[model samples]
Target: GLRVLDNLPAPSLPCEQDRLRDFMGRRERGELLIQKINKLQEKLLKKMQLSVSKDGFVHFGDTVMLLNPDSKSSVKNCPGACVRLTLAINLDEISIYSFKSLEAPCGVSAVESVDPVARNTFCILSVDGAPASEPIRFGQKFSLGTTGGASDRMLYLASDHKSFIRFAKKSHLQQVFLTDELSYLTCWQAAFLDPQLRLEHEGFPVP
Candidate 1:
């Protein structure tokens, strides 16, 4: 009735054979493994982030926004008016641009409502740069020009001594010196001040 082969029972029907059952089980396990791999791939893709290019430029994904870094001009009538540029980086691309104002004749202005001492102080604001529509105020101690009278128009800050943030003219650059280490808010202000400045000293690409 029952025949033994290789110390195991041999089934008459292929479906009833132990070898067939083992093959089927292996096929099922392979399918499950493949499904798990696909799920893991999808999860990793979702976790991926965007970043800027290594050339200090932004890809902007679909369309890129070209910014002129060497362009420097006087603030004109508004002594308090200052231009700010911000640079941001993502896992995929980098972004660079200047700030704009919502109101016409967008420029720096003194906060009259604040305090009298604060009146001399002004905010650097813009609409086009990163963290748009925010105010960038003077650091603790802002100095206009160089320490030894090297330049007059450029503004240098204590936060960054290597480069000047504000440039009034080609020959003259203003300098600003901060009283203390930069804070979160001031750091953001510094970002808007100049992307090149942030890149030179801040270490991060600029955002």
Candidate 2:
């Protein structure tokens, strides 16, 4: 009755087990790569010799910046899903650092900045169809919409600041983006998007 399994050679693993093992292997590899990239970025940060401010901002060199070392300033009233967000600025990109915050930090996430007075008009910027629920980052590159109807893009460098904004736009509409359109986020939403005004890019003038 017992064939000793010599004729069978070995009992090959099941297909599902093989698949699970492969998936785990890939996940481990992916995590290792992410860790390596993060370390490289850390080295780059040190080479630049950056310093953090008291309020917790890692900035300077004009082209790059980091806000809230491990991410901070929790959004108020998010109920069951509020998570901290990181504000990372690499040469050409000015984006919220959290992998998950893109959708969460949007809408009216920066509610505290709403004020009747002491308010300044900020132009919303986007790429392709993305909405501007983030800061204009003070020094972000922006160009006037051409008469032919071309939109601007962000390069996130102070040196790339546009000399002028488009003139064809009418008076009131120039500064305000309605809530209905994805073309831009409302001012209140923009404030919520940047409650701390991380884009103020201190040391640099409010251009």
Candidate 3:
């Protein structure tokens, strides 16, 4: 992490431009969450209080990380599981980090996308290969980042809802999801948090 911080502009940002904006913005506000990061760079990148990862993770000089809110020492272990930190657009005070399941989910109803990438429409279902029971909405007022990017769409869902998909963008079997490594973490974060849509096996490569 210090090495990358020393390298600044060249530090690999695996995420899209939007995610970086939030980090840089918060640095301006002098938020404490970011202060912890700055303190890590006080000495040479090799001073090594904390180490930065190219993949979507941060670590202290050692491997075993222990965080205790009651102790100031815990700040070193802070940012747990969160890769790139950002403020929710609507919830300005909240921070979001991408987290991926260590293991894939099991026994959950499947979700698949019916919308083809060539077209902007995205229809989805949990069934093995059945047509949706309801009509598909051609477009929506909001977007995760890209208009037709499925992952971005899913990230939007994760951040915006209390009961994400309490009423899915559609009706039918669905629910829950969760995020990524350093450079790849943002998009991967969107992919995992995207509520675990189980596209048909045949469409394994669904957009």
Candidate maximizing TM-score: 2
Model 1 agreement with the true structure over 1-207: per-residue lDDT tens digits: 997678676656866687778867867775445554443333222322223345553222211211223334544553554434322111111111111101111122212122112112222322234352222232211121111111112222232233465532332443223222233322322343765554454433323
What is the RMSD of candidate 1?
A: 22.2
lDDT of each: 0.29, 0.29, 0.26
Flag regions of model 2 displaced more than 4 Å: 1-13, 31-207
Ranking by lDDT: 1, 2, 3
Q: For model 1, where is the 10-residue window of minimal lDDT?
A: 93-102
Candidate 3 on 1-69: residue-level lDDT in tens? Answer: 454456447645566676778778878876545474443222112211222244342211211111212
Alpha-carbon error at 90 in model 1, in Å?
17
Write the candidate numbers in order of decreasing TM-score: 2, 1, 3
Position 22, candidate 2: lDDT: 85
lDDT tens digits, residues 30-149, model 2?
544555445434432332222224434212221222122222343344344325332222212213342211112111111221111111112233333333332233434322110001
Models 1 onward score TM values of: 0.18, 0.21, 0.14
Question: How much is the lDDT of residue 47 in candidate 3?
Answer: 17
User: Against the correct fold, how does model 3 do in TM-score?
Assistant: 0.14
